[model samples]
Target: MAEKTTSTVPKGQKSQFAVPYYEISYDKFFQFGVSVDCVVFGYHENRLKILLIKRGAAPFMGMWALPGDLVYPNENIDVAAQRILRDLTGIDNLFMEQTKVYGQVDRHPAGRVITTGYYSLIDIAKHDPHASAWADGVYWMDLNEVPKLAFDHSDILKDALQILQQRVRHQPVGFELLPEKFALADLQALYEAILNESYDKANFRKRILSMNLLISLKENQKDVPHRPARLYKFDKQRYDELIAKGFSFEL
Candidate 1:
C-alpha cells in the first residue's frame, strides 16, 4: 500500500498534502525526555535565599538540587512544572515564570534529557515547605551560601538569579519577596540583597516615591530598635489603572 498522506483544502482551493507519517523519523526525538527545574527565591533576615531539595535518587543521590522532575508524556510542560514544584516543596499557587532551557547532550547521565528553568519570588515567612516525592529534605539557603548543585543546576540557578535581578529593576516583582506591609528601609534592603549592591538612600527613595505605586498606610513600625519608620503597601489597584493608561514602571 502507498504511504498514507493527509490534506486540508478551503472551498475552491487546491488541496495541500502533508508528508506521510512513515516518511518522517521520530525515533531520535523519542529518546529525549523533557523536565523542569524551579528556582524559588525568598527574602529573609535581610538576605536573599533559595529553596533547595536533598535528592533521594541516583545520579547525584543525597546531593542538593532545585526541586525538579521529568514531564509525563501526556502532560503540559507548564503544568508539569507546577506539579513538580508543589510535590517537592509543598508550596502551591505561587506564580512562576520560565527563565531558560538547558539541553546539553550530557546534562543527564541516565539518558538524554532537556530541562526548562522557572523562577518565582515569595515571602519566606508566608509558607513552610516540606520535602516529599524524590526529595528527602527541603530548606532555604542563603543565595551567597548555596552549595555546588547536582547536574547543571548551578548554571540554571545563576541564570535565574540574573533574570530576577534584571526584572526587579524594571518591575515590582521584588515586592513579592517582602511582607505585605513594610518599611521603606525594608524595601531598599530587599532590593540591595537581590542586586548584590547598595543604592543611594535619597535617590532611591525619591525615585520609588515618585512612581506613586506605594500607599502610606499611616502606620509605623512597632517594637523595633531605634526610631520606627513609616510603613507602606504596594498600591496594586492604582498600578493596574496606571498600566492601562500607559505608565511604565522602572527603577
Candidate 2:
C-alpha cells in the first residue's frame, strides 16, 4: 500500500504554500576579495631599513605590520599599492615592482582576502616624513630587527629581499635610493649593502664604468679631510637608448 503524507497548519497560522521568505543560489559560492601590501625599503646611515606602521584598526590593532589596505572595487592592484603608499608615507614617484600574491585561505582574519605584494625603494631623506596621518607613529626599523609582523608579512619581505638582491646585480635600481649625484664608492657601497657581501672594488668599478651609463660631473665630494672623489650622475637618456637597442645591464 502507498503511504500518504499530509500537510498540517494551525488555525492562526498562514498557509504552508505561501511565498518563500528567502532564496539561495549556487552561483555565489566562490567569491573573494583583493588587497595590496607595500614592502617599503629605505636606505639610511648605511643600514637597510623597512617601513612599518602600528595598526590603528582591529584584526591586529597596535601590532606592527607592513603598510597595506583593502583595494577599492574599481581600482587595479598596482594602483592600490601606490595609493596605500601615498596614504601611509606621503611619498610618491617610488620605484615599485610587483613581488607576489598571498592567497592563503586564513591569511586574513577578517575574511578571505588575496593580497598582492609590491616592493618599493625610496631615499629616506628625499621623502616627506609627515605625508600620511599615520606617519607620525610609523617608523623605519632595521631589516635585521624586524619584529613579529601581522599576517605573512615576514615571508613577503623575505621574497622581496631576494628579488632586490638579484635586481641590484643586473639593474641600475640602486640609483633610486641614492642622491642625484653619487661617487663610485657610494654606488659600490649601496650594491654591497643590498648584496650583503663584499665585492672586489676594482672589478666592480670596471664593470660599472664599462657600461658607459654614467655622466661624469665636474663636482667632487666636499667637506672631507681625505682626497675628494669625482662625482657622477646616471644618464637616463643614454640608458634608455641603450636599452632600446637590446643592451643588457648585467654584472
Candidate 3:
C-alpha cells in the first residue's frame, strides 16, 4: 500500500491559503473583558421611558449609564445579562435578548472591554424599578429626554429603541406592557407612544377590532373627568386559536 497524499484545494485550482499558520502563548496575546448592559424600557403615563442609573464608581463615575457590569468567568452570557437586569430592577426571569456587541478599541476606559447590549420592555406601574446604593440616582427617563450617557451606552440605547419601535408594530409583545383589561383607546395610545406617531381613530379601531382578539369587558373607566370608555382585555386564547389555524398577526 502506497502512502496517500491529500489536499483540500481542488486539483484544477491553486490554494489561496498560502500564508503560514502558527500558535503563540494564549496568555501573551491581547485580551479583552466582556460585560453586559441592559436598556430597560418602561411604558407609563403614555410615554416611553428607559431606566438609567448614575454610575457610582470611578471611570465615568456619577454619570448616567445603562445598568450593567462585567461578566464573570463562569457565567453564561444570558445569565450575566439577567444578573445585570435583576440587580438593577429586582425583576427575575426576564427575556433579555442580546441585541448587539460593541467592541471599539477605545470604548471603555478599563482597557480593552467589549459589551453585549440587551433590552427589556415592561409595564412601569406594575414594577417600580429601584437603584442600588452604588447608583446615586435611578429614574425612568423618557426616551426624548435621554441625556449623554457613559461609554457607548448612548449608541446602545439608540439601537435598542429602534428595535423596540419595530418589534412592537409587528408583535404581540406590546400587550405585555399593558394591563389585563384595557380600552381601544388605551391600545392606540400605546402604539402611538411607541411609534412616535398618531393613527386615525376610525381606521385604527376598525382594523384592530377586525382581528377579534379583544374581549369586551362590562366595566367602564372610572375616576375620569371625561366620559368613561368601555374596557376590553386581550384574549390570548383567541390569539392562540387564530395562530394555530394559520392566521398571522400584523399591524
Candidate 4:
C-alpha cells in the first residue's frame, strides 16, 4: 500500500499552512485588576475604631484611605486580604469575612480597578504596635469621628458598618472585638458602640443573659478602682449547638 499524506490546511484553502490573520499585542489586551480593602473594626476604650492608612503614592497622596492594596498576581482574594490586613494593622488570624465587591469605573483615580471589601473584627489588645508603625500612616480613628476618606473608602466603611450592625443582632461576631473574658457591661458597650446609641443596661443584660451564650467566670473584674463587676466569656460550643438547633440571637 502507498503511504498517504494529509494536508495541514482547512478545506478549500490552497496553501497547506494557514497564516495568522490578526495579532494581539500584549499591551492592547484588557487587564482586569483586583484589590482587597479591609474594614477593620475594633472596640476599645468604649468606642468603635476603624483602621486607616495614609496614601504613600500618587492619585491620593497624603490622603487617608482604608488599609488595602492591589491583590498580588500570585495571591488569591482571601489571601490578599489577610496579607494586607497583617501588613497594615499587624494583626493576623482575626475574624474576617468578605462583605461586598465594588466595581465603579471611577473608583480608583489611578486606573480602572475592582475591589473586594472585607470586614474584620479584632481585639485591639492583640495588635502589634511595631508592625502597625511600618505604614506611611496608620491610625485607629473613632468610628463616629471619621474624616473624609480617599477614593470610595467612605462608602465601603459605611456598608461594612451597616453589615456589622445587622450581624451583631443575629450573630456572635461581637465576641471577636471584645476581650476574651469580658463582663456583661462590656458586651452592652460593644453593641452600643456599633449602633451608635446607648441601651438600657439592665434590659440589655436581661436579654443577652437569657440567651445563655455567656459563661460566668466566677471571677470579678480586675484592676479597677471601683467594685469589680463579674467577668464572663462567650460560650462558643453552646452557641454553635444552639445555632445548629435553629436558635437565633436577636437583640
What lDDT score belongs to each candidate, Candidate 1 first? 0.85, 0.78, 0.80, 0.78
Candidate order by TM-score, highest to lowest? 1, 3, 4, 2
The reply for model 4, stretches above 4 Å from the true place, is 1-29, 129-134, 222-227, 242-251
Top candidate when judged by lDDT against the true structure: 1
Q: What is the per-residue lDDT of model 1 for residues 1-251, given as tens digits with 9 covering 90 to 100?
A: 43444334555644333332224244545778899999999878888899999999998999999999999999999999989999998998878999999998789999889999999988899889999888999989999899999999999999999998887665664456667899889888888898898888888798879988899998899999879999998898766655456544344
Poorest lDDT segment (10 consecutive residues) of candidate 4: 16-25
TM-score of model number 3: 0.83
Of the two candidates 3 and 4, the one with more favorable lDDT, higher being better, is 3
Candidate 2 error regions (>4 Å): 1-30, 93-95, 131-136, 241-251
Tell me the spans in candidate 3 whose CA falls farther than 4 Å from its real position. 1-25, 28-30, 240-251
lDDT of 3: 0.80
Residue-level lDDT of model 4, residues 1-251, one tens digit each, is 43444334555655423552333345433476799899988778788898888877776878888888889888988988888878776777766898899998779877788999999766677675322533577788788888999889999999999997777666655555767898888788777887787888788888888888889998999898888999998898977766566444444
Which pairs, if any, clash in model 4?
none
Model 3 pairs whose backbones collide: none
Worst 10 residues of 3 by lDDT: 19-28
Better of 3 and 4 by TM-score: 3
lDDT of 3 at 212: 84
Per-residue lDDT of candidate 3, residues 99-172 (tens digit): 88998878988788889999988888877667764676678899999899999999999999888777665565
